[model samples]
Target: MPAPATPEAPAGWDFSDVVGSDSSLRRFLHGLPGVDQVGAEARAAQLGTRSIKTTAKAFALDLAIRMVDLTTLEGQDTPGKVRALAAKAMRPDPSDPTCPPAAAVCVYPDMVADVKQVLGDSGVKVASVATAFPSGRAALDVKLADTRDAVAAGADEIDMVIDRGAFLSGRYLQVFEEIVAVREACTAADGREAHLKVIFETGELQTLDNVRRASWLAMMAGGHFIKTSTGKVQPAATLPVTLVMLEAVRDFREATGQMVGVKPAGGIRSSKDAIKYLVMVNEVAGADWLDPDWFRFGASTLLNDLLMQRTKMTTGRYSGPDYFTLD
Candidate 1:
């Protein structure tokens, strides 16, 4: 049995356990076999009615190029780091024209001001990872406050990590509650809802089924976006894992008519990989979500490849990724 919808997890609660009193495990298990075929072709056929104007050919490069503006470019990546990101965002280099369509420039909460300044008038949003990021182990108040602070700092979006320890311990309800609360905390900031992307660190979860379940859990808990990995873990993003996630997104849409977003982070080092993801998204989600609004890639080094590919397609010659550093 899972804990009721009160924002509290026992000192040590367990959710995925069949051997526990406080958890959604029994329920989850009972419902497992039903979702097993979520990635099947039959599921895709169901999505035909949900199709929008999205297609890989049209939106692959755009989504691939929408840089998350990782603030880690500089060591003490504080407000100054955000400014530096903005500078890089605004720099006009002949090698990389059009700049990254400026997906939310990710930064620490404290640097929201600098990111805002750097991205001024460009419509690029600012996203901040919070709530003890890469590890959601913290006092609820502390985590909520951190998320609040980020939004107060002008973060247009929030990326938060779940407590893997708790989740792995069979505590699905706790994970669910924490994410919901953080979502609330983010929305409370800026006197409106700031977008929230929940990072599941699927690599740590260790199975495509768990990844799919986690994706569903996040969506059910109100995550506007279900993201993979924190980019801090190895085996960040993989085709099989992402295929599972997109398949979940497709099912959730069929069940609720809600279209949540998908972001694959970590270790995607080349444009070709991005294109492959694009292929998956198109094949899975159909053509309606080809816009940058619903899709994103968390990458620091993938941009040059996207540019190179786009350039090659236009100019009919291969350009090295280093071409971005030149003119």
Candidate 2:
């Protein structure tokens, strides 16, 4: 190796400010889901803002994405209502040709077989939630049993939420240990098998520093994907939170060379918003990982808007969200 060159500033490069300072750390901090400041108007402003409409190209990148568990969606999902929503979410209709091919159908573990049979030879995988979703407050034995049952039922992917209450209340070790055991459980029951996405419910965490730490903790604990929000929380999946996670992914990649995935579930209501997320990935994580395998948007309400946008792009006249049916 050549002798180390003296640390000299390259022309206009300013190292004095960042070479060794808290400001560097702050700059990293600033990048995490800076969403509190970006309200709906700001998000609206980002519309017509360079969208990657779901097209053959968008679907063709090396990776694949499945919109998991849209039926058990938050905001309006209730007991009697869930089954119908789950049924409709899995149903395929003739009118909506613009809908992208979901890599899998995500459902409550009970609905896995229903979706599996309905999707039939279409090759979409089946995913199920485990470890007591929405709130991961179950007894460890119960949670493990839940995981075992879902896998035994043939779920190809497992989307699990971490205990946010425990994580935020300074029980980091508890969360870490839980994820490790759950991951191990997945392996034992399903082979080194089902993909594990550890949902952080990032909206509930008070700060991005916490988000970064949680991201690291989840990945370190063997989570295949680190996700944002349960969509049940008040502030699920905003651009800023996602930005923070992407930066975390970047740093994690640099540090450990592990290519982790990201999922931004909830509140993604339109193709424009989805594109903004794609923009964040391009700008932050680079074009190399732009495929859906590395990123996903989880929302029942979003697919319609993405279809409407796709329709308008080809025909040049927009159809309102209402006119564009979700079937």
Candidate 3:
């Protein structure tokens, strides 16, 4: 049985025995129940078709805005651009102060300080993507350094991608150790560690079974959140894949009494799509995961769509995309 939570595993459960060795880690991961692709897909499809009342739609729209990780991970991202993004995150609808701010603003590590400056005391978190980012191809030291630099720069959260190559090649222990190491690197000099969001890049995992394994691996290795994608890969954050992940977290909480957040980054830009995810979270993971602290969307354009939907719901007319800041 898993041990109760320790200082290392702060989520109220520890899996030291499961990760004690390469053989044991592999055995436990492989022993996990396989995914039923057909059922998962059908369930996700059915959930996607379920409609909420107008009041709930309004609530979901605001909740989605609050759950957004308003991300910009391009090479051309500038400090000024990040500041504007941070401003937008702080006040998503300036005209409508009733509108809720976004949960966080995600950028590359170098820009975490800029975001922090703009978001100071706003309660909006500064999340930086580290560990080689979209491609987790760097060495262990390089990845840890990347994480430490971001935390040292005042990042509240670190989104690190797991090495898909190591995972696919059966180097489960290597991947686990890397996640654990990066989790350690999130600590600052004063002792506060940024919450670690472990991205599986599930599209490349190539199977629902792999998604399930990756979820457990991340949670077992002490990731505060298990994310669906890095938002660079094609087919990022599909509903079926997210369903599998939600199921994993639900089962995990039951077994270990710890709740891990889920983030479906990329390709989820529509308000309708975001609401479907909210519904699924309620059904699969229960109401606890419905909060912004327990769920997030890692999209850049999703905020605009949510704002437009919120305006429509309140005023009975849809706001054009041009109405909001393009950034």
Point to the candidate with the largest lDDT: 3
Tell me the tens digit of each residue's lDDT in model 3 across 1-327: 121122223345678778889899999888887777888888899988998998888889999999999999999999999999999999999999999999999999999999999999999999999999889888889999999999999999999999999999999999999999999999999999899999999989999989999999998899999999998998899999999888888888877788899999989989999999999999878999999899999999999999999999999998999999997
* Positional deviation of residue 131's Cα in model 1 after best superposition, in angstroms: 0.9
Pairs with backbone N, CA or C atoms under 3 Å apart (clashes), candidate 2: 32-244, 33-240, 33-241
lDDT tens digits by residue: candidate 1, 262-322? 8888888676677667766787766565556677777766655666766766677987756
lDDT string for model 2 (1-327, tens) is 111122232433322343144345344333434333334235434532754535743452212223433545344534345444434444322365544465555567766666655555655566678898878889988887888777777767788889888877666667777887888777644364778889988878877667776786787678888889777887888766676677667766665667788888878776556666776677666775575566766776766665555556567777786764452
- Once all C-alphas are superposed, what RMSD does model 3 give against the true structure? 3.8
Error of 3 at 174 (Å): 0.6
Error of 3 at 291 (Å): 0.4
Q: Which candidate, 2 or 3, would have the higher lDDT against the true structure?
A: 3
| Cα distance off (Å), candidate 1, residue 274 | 0.3
* lDDT, candidate 3, at 73: 93
Give the candidate number with the greatest TM-score: 3
Residue 204 displacement (Å), model 3: 0.4
The 10-residue segment of model 2 with minimum total lDDT is 1-10
